[model samples]
Target chain A: MSGISLSTTSYRNVSIVLFTLLVVTLVLAELHLGPLAWVAALVIACAKTVLVAVYFMHLRFATPLTRVFALAGVVWYVILLGLTLGDVLTRAH
Target chain B: MTHLAIAPQFDDAAQQHESAALGMWAFLATEVLFFGGLLTVYTVYRMAHPAAFAEASSHLYTWIGAVNTVVLLLSSWTMALAVHAGAHGERARIIRMLAATMALGLAFLLLKAVEYYLDFHDHLVPGRAFRPDWSTNAPAAQMFFILYFILTGMHAAHMLVGVLVVACFVAVIRTTPSPARHANALELVGLYWHFVDIVWIFLFPLLYLVA
Candidate 1:
């Protein structure tokens, strides 16, 4: 999985690996891991999103402009989280 | 005949494919913001009443949410393969994969229906008739359920659209049957399918696991 594997994965293998990862994380995320459960779940979700974006969406072979457009979602999302959450988290009750 | 597949508006196949992909990403960008707004709301409300949000979240059926997550991710995988086949012009492969993706989407929706039914029975749905074991925090809990239903309902609506889109993609492939020339179609559908999956990727933990 260098630079998204260059479309190297077959569908069956890709599905199986991804499904297994999801199941394992789901089962694990259910336990009482304190705040860690939340953290772990978020991390797993990010990883899963990356897997789908890079592999399933074929961003590996995408042009730089296209990749920029694709990444714009993630980048802009962080901005959304940053600005709004910063305001919310910091404001007085 | 094969050359006519390249629309008159496009000079060549590759450029057409690139343009199509770029357009899809641009669309997905807006979709991200659309869902992002809801999620931002989620964050704000949760921060305001973390305990009540957590309580309401716990009332959610973890099993149902977990299973749905699996279903959607698997569907994305299937769509990936279908797109792979489409890129190479494998008609049978494209049909099979697309069918699998659509069926998985349907299965996800079916499970969602079951969850909604059970939540309603449990009085987890917010309305005048709302009731929950955590009645003391009922107001904040009700707020949680409101966002819950709205977000997941919106998500389910998107999934329904995904199913129909896959169905249409199947029809397109059947008519064109030229893998190399029609590669853009496959790629575009795969992108949309995965975008839906990505949305769930964020929603699952926020709604289900964080509690």
Candidate 2:
């Protein structure tokens, strides 16, 4: 919970909370939400992704090289989205 | 014995752990790009045929997808625990958690198999000869199904790989002499497993959340 070095007890504790959130978010996103479902879904998904990265992937205590590589994918993905959406959204006949 | 003997380049336990973690991250980054290509196709098609995209997306089995998401989320938690056990040099705990994660992953695959069976039976599979009573826009709908199968199918393949990887980790735990040397294996496999879950995180919304 506190740092890069994760303990099994910590993992188990975090698992319970994260999983409960996963279920709750899925139910809420599926049932009541309509157009805004994706927003909720993305937020929950981001939370889960961060948890896995920081804990299981060891990115919390990873070296500078590792962090750079991890962030590179994210930065590149964002750039991909920006460029693609820019092309699609900004284009006109 | 060979695995227990020593890795050539790694000097100490910490170096081995760092290298393995970093190596797995690099592999996952490439995986991100691999999935990125398919996601690009999805974005383009969704843009081109918004109505049909919405229609096709509406036909997905939302409950099944949601359940599988929960399953994977739980499995990832187990995976994180397995890594924790490894870091603490608790070999038995590592084995137990790894096995649990692998079983959950297999359960996810079985559920996905059922979903595909329904797809085929429903004629939801994309093809020129396809027939569906749900919508007249069969072509676009078929394309969506195609993308769905390809994307999720590829993901399932990755899950299978994760399962095998976890199984291997279990075996290593049984046979490897220096458990300390191989603690990094747990972290490496955990990295891959988490990446698989993260992909599904995005997939759940893309496939099932359309209104």
Candidate 3:
């Protein structure tokens, strides 16, 4: 069997977990906790992204090099958002 | 076990699969940057006009966005299952799962079409016809709708392409002699599909839940 292959049962388990997290995030959105709501939504979104990438996309079973390559995109994206936001948020009114 | 015919460039099936997987990941890495650029722009504008963005977000059909998220997630799950079946050389199961995935993809597009229709009816298209019902900051609210259309339109375009590719793949696999040999190909397609799903995973919150 290939390293990337997971059993049917495992896929079902992951899907259930993903659905549950989706519900939680939706509930959080409905709570309207100001900035905390946004933070919670984004945090849960990241968690859901990791779950899909790791299990559905089979990154967990991928080779170390593949994993690094995958992480590279996300890391670069963070830098892009981070630096831009840093400049924008800190600019004088 | 059925023997896999190794390509001239590859020493074995495993090597071929890994090379293909690596190449797909490389493509996906570029895709990440592609969508990331738009998201960064959205964040910058959103931070600049938080009130406008929030008001515009409130006008969206949150229920439709929520349902579509579930649809895309379900499609990703089905795509993953199809890849799993492909690894086992279960041709029938692979076809079934791919069909289910494709069906879900179409369903998402359909829902998106409904949302777009409603958005148009509400004058949310961000041009001369753009008339936001908000009492304050109409111009900034228009910017929010501009980003809204661009981001969701780009995402819907990806979904359309995915549905087409999966449809063609299903047709080809149905006639192929050994579908298991195409497992790597299936996995690559699944990666693309799942990456698109992940994009929506972020988009839903950023676009719909802002209020």
Candidate 4:
């Protein structure tokens, strides 16, 4: 039961590392990647999001039901994109 | 453990956790639809005027957008830290993180304001008064800029509300005796924060990178 607890130091450390990585990625993206730099930008973003959800949000120790709720949000987003785009693409120009 | 062991226990912590998770998930589903409508509109315009869209986008302050993205990302990081503090029963730490998140959120809104000001000065804003220096497809480009302002402006409004909410939460943490019930509240805010960040992630690529 106690295994779920995260220390403040660890949290700070993680935040530092994530922020540093984000800054570095932004610099690199600006310097060399051009418009396509969004790929690197997004990868860093996904990593940061995961870290927040897992460690900060306590999703790591959350019951399966909570995970289901978060996953449902993602799935719903996809369905929304799919259905809307379907109509958009199929409509006459 | 037998079914009876877990069944019929209104006080069962596990069952409560499950229900909470389910509730949060249901709300997030609605959020998906909310953002989906905007995405659809954005997509339609992009498809309608691909070249104009690209040209219009080039006028944007790319570095400002990049900085805003990082700022929001940092807010999310602090928010996550706040939630972690809540779970660990560290009220002080949670309050600190909440304050940090609010500050970063404010910073993002400030940067956005500056960007908007620049837009206005450059005549990049739409509504019958746009005057792009090097123009192509002025009408379509104007429409694109209009949509950009509305969408990002709405996002900024949300961020403003989010900052207020976080400030209120911090106050609660500081004043009231901490309650376990607030855990879910913290989590809900985290969900909202994450959703905002996700929207921007898509926006950055669509508006700035889709050349």
For candidate 4, write residues A1-93 as lDDT tens digits.
123567667677777876676676657655656445646766766676577667755678777767877777677767777887788889986
Better of 1 and 3 by lDDT: 3
Model 4 stretches with alpha carbons more than 4 Å out: A1-3, A6-55, A87-93, B1-10, B179-181
The per-residue C-alpha lDDT of model 1 at residue A30 equals: 57
Per-residue C-alpha lDDT of model 1 across residues B121-190, encoded as one tens digit per residue:
9988888779877656888899889999999999999999989989988887777746556666667878
The candidate that wins on TM-score is: 3
Instruction: Give the poorly placed runs of model 2, Cα more than 4 Å off.
Output: A1-4, A31-34, B1-8
Ranking of models by TM-score: 3, 1, 2, 4
Instruction: Please give me the DockQ of candidate 2 compared with the native complex.
Output: 0.51
Which clashing pairs does model 2 show? none
TM-score of 4: 0.80
DockQ each: 0.54, 0.51, 0.73, 0.34
Ranking by DockQ: 3, 1, 2, 4
Best by DockQ: 3
Using lDDT as the measure, what is the rank order of every candidate, best first? 3, 1, 2, 4
**TM-score for each prediction?**
0.91, 0.90, 0.97, 0.80
In angstroms and one decimal each, the interface RMSD of every candidate reads 3.7, 3.7, 1.3, 4.7
